[model samples]
Target: MAVTVISLVVAFLYGGPQALFLCVILGILEVSLSFDNAVINATVLRRMSEFWQRIFLTVGILIAVFGMRLVFPLAIVWIASGLGPIAALDLALNPPPDGAAYFPNGDPSYETLITDAHPQIAAFGGMFLLMLFLHFILEDREIKWLEWLERPLAKAGKLEQLEVVVATALLLITATVIAPDDKVSTVMIAGALGMITYIAVNGLGEMFHVPEEGEEPEGGPSGLAKATGKAGFFLFLYLEVLDASFSFDGVIGAFAITSDPIIIALGLGFIGAMFVRSITIFLVRKGTLSDYVYLEHGAHWAIGALALILLYSIGTHVPEVITGLVGVALIGAALGSSIYRNRKIAAREGEDAVKTSIP
Candidate 1:
């Protein structure tokens, strides 16, 4: 509550009452877009130790707010303009010159700089998310959704690192066919980096993971043991990467709503990130995935849709509303399916109990 009040005050002080209102709207927009992210985060977070969870709330939030929301944009500007960090910061704070090509009204704004870099950002984020979705679907699991498609992928998973191959192929195809001539190299490079990041983080997590007794070597342990220091360290890295990937769209999308870096950081960083962490913890405590049975499936499908949209966006302008709604629709359908299944089971159990009583 205190943090929220302070952030709002800062927003108001920075840009008056209108900025404060925009900040609140941006925060809500971020949360709405990232509901699927919360579900996906919970899926991995439940496996982490309590200490790590605390770190996610504290250290993770700082990185999300300051590092990605603030520093990252500055770094991008620096790289793009060959300017120093201080210069980039100045550019972001000061409005773009009048009649600039980037803004709708030819107003000079930081939004122009960030929007110009969208292709690379989209390529990187798209590939990373694609790999994540593919990894989940291609792996063998007890629960299945869309088995007709998933079954083949699961069978193909028998091959070592098949997901990497598929991701590479898709990236190549996207760069060759869809990317503009000037942006081709940028797309390829960003996409490769995204894929490499996912592989490195995932490998590190698996390297330190220790299987519990009687666990199948392939199945691995369900969760990391609190005593294993290395396990916690690598899991922390994985979680951070996951959070960053989830933030990619939100960070980019936030620019559409506001050009002010301070407002963007305070709104999306503080409110949206805090809510996501809270949702993760709530899901973990309630065992929501296990109870629903299909929620995880829904989240992954939503991820797949997001991945495709990111890739498609490289060639065309896809509205943020469409991107967000696709996820909500998939997750909503999954929840409905889960409720129906639960009721059916309850009805069968009740019938069996009544028969036994009659006897």
Candidate 2:
């Protein structure tokens, strides 16, 4: 397929076997870390026509390469410069760069750039995701508060997740107001920007969302397919965003092993994404979710662990490998349990069938 060719082309541009290896490794790692995201995304994909599903994967590629692998580091650099000097030092000390692009003309050591940027990226990503997850958790799923408010406006769409994001923004603003006027403001600003991004992306999803029945019900997204569709799309969107967050550590950490940013990006971008996509397909085709009750439970636990790692990465340096291992262990345990459960259920069903035959 075109995607496969493009992935290889990108890898070739980065150059070398090491680049290929890293791309494969990081891609696999990303997919594994984000299994829950894939499952959740599938829920949305089910609603979309086959055409839309392909679009998701294609757009997803763009997000990973341009947003996470490329622009994100620069954004983090901006955040670091805006914060204090010590923050930058903390980030830079970890690793050195392999090479430099033409625009900069100088191959600033990875260690130096990271240290200069400060490690606040970890906090920015961690807290931002944490808040988004919490909003989903706390939102009034049972009641349509937005529907009531929109009665006068005659809006057909329910409030959706927009309220949760706004609430998060408000909370960040409050924190900004209460904190000391110096560095806290900078951190708060970063957090706010993160939330704003969430709003922007989710808004795009809503805008592009082509619900059946042409218009959503007064309550919005009713029925199993509709509900799962929206949730899954949001889940997919969140996963991509989450993957972007996870990549910060992976890309930065790649330098500790090698200095080439091209290699780092290629390694972490294409191969990593492919592995995850393959896993996602397997899970979907096999009906892993339906077959194993606790699979989702395990994935959420991994998500939580990754979130913690992201938060900790702010003040303390946590290796990307450690984060990957923790997630793998959790998901592995879940898969094992699922196997045992399926066997037990099969045995019970066999017994019942035997008894009926005897009669």
Candidate 3:
């Protein structure tokens, strides 16, 4: 409700049907690019409780709008500038010559320009996304390179941290191997930021005094409701995070078409994200993932493709539309397959019912 009202106000304030149309087009684009995110998010959201869902819808917006929309672009600018946060602040306040070029057309040419102006940060974000995709692929498979270390760690009951340490080390190594020529320091900084964010969100959640609803006395139904709520909140946060990451390309790509920041943020931020959120919720309620087997699998595959697009953007150019359309096609195929499976099941059930009656 608040988001809607705020969007309305912004729309009116930024008046002109052009803004509204941009909003509509960008909204469609954003939803299309991140549709897979919605499906995967459902996997986590299913575990959350109703109360948490509301918090997610509310607080989650803050994280998306402020954190992703505002901070992320600034972060890129800071890293690219190779300046401290203070220096970055100065640059933001007092524009440098042609800083306007950064937001060209609606795409942040920071990546292309960063290749010239701030290559390091661009490389870092690309490498980071690549590592994440690779790590995801590895986790899905069962390769035990750590069996020897795992044995000793498990004996001491401290294997989980060891696994994390190993993963972190691996990512760092990958980043180092592919360190960008122009922005090595920037890449390192970006990598640190990403790591810090993960630790703060996940680790703090564990260390904090946020009490899990205490064990119900006398075996009363546990406040599984609260737990579910927390889960839902986390799921919502996950969706926001996923949305932000997915939109980075679109936001940057929009610049390829136009140089208007107002249009970029206004068009993409409000319109694109809303439709995506609605479609995600509709699918969740409909249990599309479960009913349409392999949808999650397809979405994940799309994520992998997007990650590649980001990485490729590091070396050469790839159109945002290409990346988005690829994702849509993959997910669409999954949905189509699911429909076929559902129909087949229905037909089988009907046949069985008829056979039983005949007998």
lDDT of 2: 0.57
State the displacement of the C-alpha of residue 206, model 2, in Å, after optimal TM-score superposition: 9.2
After superposition, which runs of candidate 3 have C-alpha atoms over 4 Å from their true positions? 1-18, 75-180, 188-237
Q: Kindly report which residue stretches of model 1 are placed more than 4 angstroms away from their true locations once superposed.
A: 97-99, 102-109, 210-228
Candidate 3 lDDT over residue span 157-265, tens digit each: 3334443464366445535654455645655666566545544444433322123324232332334643454434454554565565666676666656443445445
| lDDT for model 1 | 0.83
Q: After superposition, how far is residue 329 of candidate 3 from its true place, in Å?
A: 0.8
> How high a TM-score does candidate 3 get?
0.68
TM-score of 1: 0.91
Q: Rank by TM-score, descending?
A: 1, 3, 2
**lDDT, candidate 1, 38-135, per-residue tens:** 89988777777788878888998899899888888877878777778877787787765562545465433567778878889989989988999999
Sliding window of 10 residues with minimal summed lDDT for model 3? 204-213
lDDT on C-alpha atoms for all candidate structures: 0.83, 0.57, 0.56
Count the clashes in each prediction: 1, 20, 17
Q: Indicate whether candidate 1 or candidate 3 has the larger TM-score.
A: 1
